[model samples]
Target: MMKLFHSPTSPYVRKVMACVLLRGLQGKVELVPTSPMQNPGDLQAANPLGKIPCLVTEDGTAIYDSPVICEYLDGLGNAAPLFPAPGPARIASLTLQALADGIADAAVARQQGRAQQEEAGPTPRQAAFQERQLAAIRRGLAALEASPPAALAEIGAVAAACALGYLDLRLPELGWRATHPKLAAWLASVEASPALSRTLPPTA
Candidate 1:
């Protein structure tokens, strides 16, 4: 079985888990609970960049990053392609995925900054860093809401939904849903999918 190194709270990891369920590949992949901070060496061994959502294949070939892992899983089942073949539609979906991933990355950075501020002293220029990240997230959300995708099965829609869900999970105070009702509704629709519903993050 393929082994997936992941943290429960990671949106990227959640994406892979959702894809696995959607593609009916659950029986073939093993989930290994791993954290970057708690199991740095293991994560680094699997991925030199020490990222979560690394997939170690049966042959011990490790794949890092959520997109690659997702595509690999999609290939395993010949399920509906999360990513379409090369074309304008494919580019749009891939671009949306990239934007959503960027949003998730920004949100994670902001959360880390806040955590560091509360733990020890604040990191240098933490407020500025956070403001920039928040701005980027907001802009991305606005763009997505303005142009909602036609369907949710594609990689872009999955990424956008996961990004929004992560924001709700991590930074509720931001009140993103208030300003972006369309995006919020889109998220609600996507969340209805059993694959995504099964992987909802637990509330702390």
Candidate 2:
């Protein structure tokens, strides 16, 4: 069996968990709740970056970062493929994945910055940094609004759902759903999928 360092509220970890469920690997993988900020020694031992969603394979080969882990899981089961084959479709899926991941990245950074600001008060540099993150999130939302994914059938769609879920979790003040109705509708349509529903980021 494999072991995964995990956190219930991390978008990246949630992404990996969704993929695990989609690929029917849940029983085969152990979820070890981890706090990366606390820098647990075992998590560091498996992944130098000390990130959650780090997968330690049966033989102890560690795989990391959510995208790589999802791709790895895609190879292990008979379930429909999340990743597309080598072709234009694959490229499109990958590009979409990148865009979705970029949104998740910016949103996470912006949330962290907000937490820091609450403790230390906002500085000009931090405020500028946060504005840049916010801009990236808005642009990503617009792009997806123009062309939302087709449910959670592929890696890109799964990623988009996870990203938007994060927004609902940590940045509800963004009011993204009102501004990106199409994307919001798309997400609403798929949020009930077994993979997505089961892996939802924790509210607390």
- State each model's CA lDDT, in order: 0.86, 0.91
RMSD of candidates 1 onward, in order: 1.4, 0.9
Return the top candidate by lDDT. Answer: 2
To one decimal, what is the Cα RMSD in angstroms of model 2 from the true structure?
0.9
Across residues 30-87, which tens digit of lDDT does each residue of candidate 1 receive?
A: 8888878765787798898888989999999999789998888878886787888889
Worst 10 residues of 2 by lDDT: 195-204
41-73 per-residue lDDT for model 2 (tens digits): 999999998777799999999999899999999
Clashing pairs in 1: none
Q: Which stretches of candidate 1 lie over 4 Å from their true place?
A: 122-124
